[model samples]
Target: MDVQSGLPRCSRHPDVETGIRCTRCEQPVCPSCMIPASVGFQCPDCVRGGSGTGHAPGANQPRTLVGGRLRTDGRAVTKVLMAVNLALFLAVHTAGDRLVDRLDLIGHAYYPVLGEVVGVAEGEWYRLFTSMFLHQDLVHFLFNMMGLWVIGGIVEPELGRGRFAALSLLSGLSGSALVYLLAPPNQPSLGASGMVYGLLGAWAVLARYRRSDMRPVVVFLGLNLLITFTRPDISWEAHVGGLVAGVLLTAAMVYAPRARRELVQYGACALVLLSVLGMVLVRTAVLL
Candidate 1:
């Protein structure tokens, strides 16, 4: 049993908790890192060792670090997310400020295009979700898409498609919720920076889990945080909120007990989502 986690950590992935051991080698193995054997489950190394005489190697299904089934193409969900962002960018370019007015995250603002008040405070709650995909500027779109491509590539493969998507959307929603609660009611914000920052937080958590050096990621995060605070027109609340949500969500995922991994992981996400909804309700009531 790991002294810190109080559970037997997987020998292959030290971050994962497990209750089982390989019959052949007696090394702890998580569900993903072990293969079913005749007598009992075997670790991958033992399965490959085969009969101890090196006669032939045994085959086994590949799994991600978190026990998710491996995919032929790990970046499929990332690609889809990018495509959706790109499509929305093009739509915003064509539709001009009108579409942005409709979708951007705002507390309460009167839009000439709609000839009425709008925003999350006005019961247009979908803006919290849609604003994440709406980038009105070319540079903003490019920067966010690049971040998504780079960070999502690493996180998606390990977390699998569904969990990765959930982390991203929930993080983005958390950012929007913060913006709604803190930013000026009429000051609108729209972009994927929240999601990008969330993924960055996920990356940092993953690196620490593997016992890798922390200096580089710490420096990178610090630089981004510096820019967030110093830069003009940046939504610092969104970045900070997404970072916190990502760290909590990923911790729940990577540290969950092997027996109840999926339930705990998804349940953590749902809890974050519920918290965001509560924020929206409170903020809306105050605005009204």
Candidate 2:
């Protein structure tokens, strides 16, 4: 109760008046303290308490903001991803351009070693995924790995390991699809830029959802966009595609109806992949 106005105050915020009560503890919670749960809005304390500490086994467990299970090692998935990218970079350095040509994202190109035309249009669809881990040089590899370390570390805990991995791959694939559809058939592209940009977009969305200051993210994104367009070497298509996909995917995860959250989130991911496949097929047909 508030001594000033004689009205009930939120447990978390003494100055804020609120009539809404948490579904679990029956404690009054202000709008800022309310978190959407499977049944109804709950306070942060109740959500944290339900994390399998003293609660009975099989009791309705708490979920993350995006419906993922809470984890202690939030950056576990990020480390693995970075390792994969680093391993692939080493392999490319050892094997040289032949390996790069074989693994890089290309629409269609003639390889002298094979003495024939090959590319995604010729059914090398795996390139779309493999190319994500390839990099041009030491600088490129370091830059992308650092980004994964930071952004993936932030997003993985919130979305869980599986969901975060799925988002990264799908976002990269979206970028590859755009490059395939728009770039010259013989042109080649590779890097984790798409995936990094995707994670960046997800970070922005998360910040917005939490009602945090948006200026920092907005300014950073703007700077990146400026660099993407100004630099001749950058693949704007990949950056733009990944950014768009990340925004949409994160939105679906965070804003889905609490009644069927997992279904809606994973379903959105599937739809994005299907859309990418459709784009690939159409582009392949045109190339062929």
Candidate 3:
């Protein structure tokens, strides 16, 4: 505020005095910098980052996946997810030989915490999530962790922690649903393969939407899916389910309108979960 002029000088244009403050940032602005918005006047900086802005400028964008991840800060969430996978793998081995079977998706096992052990025949439900964390062997654990290390490192920074976590978990659950629907009732399925595929799907969708070269990602995913089907012991159902979940969830995250991104993403996540739940209900009814 200028004592003599009876006006406030703009923060950016200090020489100019203004009678109004910006509605958004509430900073004094000269009329030139004051941009008219839906509610009120906003500064140029806010307008650039807000809904007024359209597609990101591709001229300055990176052309490589490595560039995309490294462009942001360190991927702490990726490291955390990897560490958790390692810890769960170790814990599964230490606990007991049968623990993996119990943790793996059974579509029928339900053991109450600190209570009696529940069997698939008893309608156990925790396996859907626990199975995602549990691994059958060191080889299985290493391969999945490798996928997480690579994919999570790439996706987490772009989507942030919450969105990535949601994608991973939903992908896992969708995999479980597929296994439940396709595999024999007594068969147990376990691994983070579904979530890994989900990350792949997410990366692919994001790259395609952003107009980046998606060939590398697509080829990698295709090769893995090939192996998934040819391998006798592999659960192809989990892979397909996870890939679909990842693509759908990531689409929701990336394609959401700028004005309602988080809201739309969370809603999409809920819709995915509900669809998974519906699958489980249909399977359970058939099993009963």
Candidate 4:
């Protein structure tokens, strides 16, 4: 029993004399105690009763969130957003054409008093957000909202509520800002097309980031971009602005290292918003 200062054999297999340590419990073990895993090996005892028995046990197993009806992640920001859009749609109808005239974005509104009240005139900016919720006609409204529901379903879970809301609002503002700068003044425009296009841009980029199949996204963007160029009476300028905002904002969110992810992402968002305002101010100075 004393071959090279033979110690007592394994606790479980005394006849087998070998020296190997359990990765988890760190007890002396023979070859028999080793359990193979994807990365290195575990001890028989550790494998039998999960990985961590010392601290908070089975902490990772349970689902933390039960997303929306479609998404089981325990979060329903997308659903809430859709509901809000629908409510606004109803409100727009209830308010009648007068509301559209007031809410729809334009480079300039003739009614300075109304514009001032709603932030649509000089130094007024509420139209940037309000316009995104308005629609010139029923068909236009449905088309844009359909795009929102489809894309929001895909993108929301990935970004979560806070970031999703930020993206939509900023993208919508950027769209209206561009329209204000480029489109003819006093010509009103409405609908969420700009925001929808922005979502498409961001979705395509994010899909590429995950190394997923990007053919469908690419095709969808191509078709929509084509339509934007061909369509008459459409503010194509807004589409361009929203697309640029979405792509850049998403890039900031996706590429940030894990060490300071939230800090960098939200910071980027704030900077983008400030840049939009800066652009608007410069445009206002030039026009007025």
Off by over 4 Å in 2: 1-62
TM-score computed on alpha carbons, candidate 1: 0.81
Give lDDT tens digits, candidate 3, residues 8-48.
78777888999875544456678998888644576676566
Q: Any runs in candidate 3 off by more than 4 Å, and if so which?
A: 1-73, 109-121
lDDT (tens digit, per residue) of candidate 4 on 24-91? 34444677676765424555656676454442343212211111112354236656656766777788
- For model 2, state the Cα shift of residue 172 in Å: 0.7
- Over the full model, what C-alpha lDDT does candidate 2 score relative to the true structure? 0.85
Q: Which residue pairs clash within candidate 3?
A: 108-120, 108-124, 109-120, 109-124, 110-124
Better of 2 and 4 by lDDT: 2
Q: What are the per-residue Cα lDDT tens digits for candidate 1 across 151-251?
A: 99989987887889888998899999999999989999999989988998998999899888989889988999999999999999899888989899888
Pairs that collide, model 1:
none
RMSD of each: 7.0, 6.1, 10.5, 9.6
Q: Which pairs clash (backbone N, Cα, C closer than 3 Å) in model 2?
A: none
| Residue-wise C-alpha lDDT for candidate 2, range 153-270, written one tens digit per residue | 8788778777898899999999999989888988889999899999999999999998989998899889989999998978898998899899999999999986788899989999
